[model samples]
Target: MSLLKEAFERFAPDYLERYGQSMLPSHRRCLTDISSCQTDALDGSLHVCQSCGHEHYTFHSCGNRSCIKCHHLRTDKWLDKQQDNILPTRHFHYIVTLPSELRPIMCSNQKKSYKILMTSAFDALQKLASDPKHLGGKIGAIAVLHTWSRAMIDHPHVHMMIPAGAYNKDDDTWIRGREKFLVPIDALKSIFRAIFMKRMRKALPKQIFPQAIWKKKWSIHINTFDSKVENLLNYLGRYVYRIAITENRVLAVSQTTVTINHNGEALHLRGEEFIRRYLQHVLPKGFHKVRYFGIMHSAHKQTRNRIKLLLMNEVIIPDRPVKKKSTRCLKCSSTLILSISVLAPRNFNCQASVHPP
Candidate 1:
């Protein structure tokens, strides 16, 4: 057995049983896929590869979005899509973290409240940019949602990737900003808070906004400019595949304690008895945890095309697979039927007829 397989065998089953209830619909489907790929166990040993006669056994991964057990292809595709989307100009990553005081309302009304968060954030950006006193342009941005901290704390925030420049409505030209493209912090905070409050007062249930938060107001944090966007872009790529805690990142799991590795430190912590606390932060089925707004929107992607043309730093995207002929059978030269084709843990089957008339 491979080293990974042993670890998986020890951890996967328990992990699933303990936390599977909170997995997203899409993640649950991956569970089914993993279960289907599992081979029958004979006295705790697995099957061999028939053609090569090689194996003690190979165990498959769940590949669930929340599992973080396997993310190779997932990361690859995500990177591929993003490669050409990068603008030639400088990019800045703005992390906007809403206060934990609002977690109750945000978590309970996740979909509705998340939508409000998006609206408020974008409105804050648009309203600020439209001001002649500021950059005075329609600034495009990509906003992604991240709803957890390292140990699965329920934190909701938006990570915005914005181009260095924006459209100048008055001049009919793009207004390029300096490398230090930071919005006025105080202005951004007030606008973000106001927009959110305005939305909540209109759309949310009375119970959602506790008297404490409503009176005191939640805090909004806008991180300092990321000097080199590459650092933060790479950060986003890694963050996309993150789960609460993976076996690799987990020091140990005991009866009463879940030992975790975070910030390069190992610490054993416990208290929340139910697995649901962590799992609650798992994204909803098929819900995109990362998203794109502004010019990245589907309706405005043509605008993106024009921007690429204007930048004149076009990048050729990679190719995708097309239907093709199958590998012939070894015993007889006949077309093979593809019984299965799996993306990971490598499964493929083909058959051929004895004779072709």
Candidate 2:
């Protein structure tokens, strides 16, 4: 059994019994899905090899994005599509982080707060880049939301990848930005702070947007990539579809504690604490964690096509076919074909039965 599966099986009931009532419906649902994923609790299919007649039973996955076992294929597919959209110019990585004082508000109102975070970051970048004193044109950007620190605590932030430069309308030419810097960090912080506070005041309580945060500068960091395009893509792929933690990062789990590796360091957390931390990042149902803004937005096809033509010489990344991985017959080593499928149980208390056509 997987370590995560084992840990959940051993300790999830106690955690759920105590805290489930107070948790969000989505969090409760995520725990239930992860606890039952790829196990007998879910439906399975009986398969027979066409060539060798070897038979096996394959269980279905929960299909939850937070489930580590189920997201690899999905992540690969997302990466493939993103690779095709990358431009040839130097790309910069920008991180927009909310002040620590506002974390509680974000935790209580995740969907609203996260939307504000993304929008504020996008607006700040676009507004700065479009200024005449700056690059003075439009740019493309991909923003991804992440909600965990290296220690697994709540640390909400947005990671953005922007092409270094913009398309100038007046000269009808591309303007390259300085390799050392894309935009002024202080300016980005001020703009982001103002935009976030302005939006938060409309929905959140007045006290949540404190005067101290307004007085203190917000945290925003920008790093320019000097490496190859392949390296940049590989790095961004890690963030595109990752959960708070992966099964591989799990080192050991006990009745009371679980150990995990984070940033090359091993950290031990109580079993209940670990589950609580993991579920905090489960995300709201139907939330879009990755978004495109400016020229990269799907609605701007004309600009996107023109930019592609301009950067045609940078790199042409082909979208290769991803092989579907599946189970095979243990007896004959042949691929298995589904001969029987058990319909999903209508109620959680019931067992699914095979319904052959």
Candidate 3:
């Protein structure tokens, strides 16, 4: 069994008992799904090996997006889909981070705050890139929201992958930004700060503290991505469907303590403390962590088609490996046949198998 599954099973009840009153419905759902994931609480499919006449039970997965066991297949599919959308041009990697003082506000209002974060960042990039001094064209940006630091602290930031050029509507051509630069860092920072503050203030509660954050200089970091699409996809796969804590990172989970490797440093935490920190990153239901804006927006089908045709002659994006379906037996190396499909018992053990008649 996975270490994460064990941790959740052991500590989730205590964590819920103490903090259930304050937890969001989404948080509860995430915990329950993860705890029951691949367990008998979900369901199981009875399979029989055709050659060995061996009968075994395979439990159903919760299919929760945050479940580490479930995200690998989704991540691969997402990466493959992105290959078609990757523009054949230079791209820039930009990071927009919120002021530390606003972390509490963002945590309470995750959906609204995260939406504002992406919108403000994309607005800033599009506005600056359209200026004649920069590139004077409409740019495309794909931003992914991440809420945790290496230490699992609440660090809200958006990582944007932007094409380092723009499509000039009037000239009907693509105008590339400077080979090494996308926009002036100072100018981008100012615009992002203004827009984010304006939107966030409206969404925030009326009685929140620390108005001094308004005076702070928000961070806007930019770096040119000179690598190919393959490298970018590989890097993005790590974060695309990542959970707060994967099973591998969990070193040991005892009755009262959990140990993890945080940035190569070992840190031990109370079981309830670990669950609390991990669940903090569980996003609200129906909230999208990754979004596309400007020329890459999903609504701009015609525009994307035009851009694809314009850049059709460029280097082709290599096709992703096709995922093989799970139809074969692992132990006997024979095709397995589904025999029975029904809801599983609450305490059925997955390791126990029924012998063939």
lDDT (0 to 1) per candidate: 0.59, 0.77, 0.79
Looking at candidate 1, the ten consecutive residues that score lowest on lDDT are 348-357
RMSD of each: 8.1, 4.2, 3.4
Model 1 misplacement above 4 A = 1-63, 169-172, 211-228, 246-248, 254-256, 270-274, 309-357
- Supply candidate 1's per-residue lDDT for 84: 57
User: What is the Å distance of residue 303 in model 1 from its true position?
Assistant: 2.4
Give the Å shift of residue 300 in candidate 3.
2.3
Q: What would the TM-score be for candidate 3 when compared with the true structure?
A: 0.90
Model 1: residue 200 alpha-carbon error in angstroms: 2.2
Which of the numbered candidates is closest to the native, going by highest lDDT?
Answer: 3
Record all residue pairs in model 3 with backbone atoms less than 3 Å apart, i.e. clashing: none
Clashes of each: 2, 0, 0
Evaluated at residue 83, the lDDT of candidate 2 is: 72
TM-score to true structure, per model: 0.69, 0.88, 0.90
**Model 3 stretches with alpha carbons more than 4 Å out:** 205-211, 312-316, 352-357
lDDT string, candidate 1, 116-155, tens digits: 8876887787788777677777776667677877766788
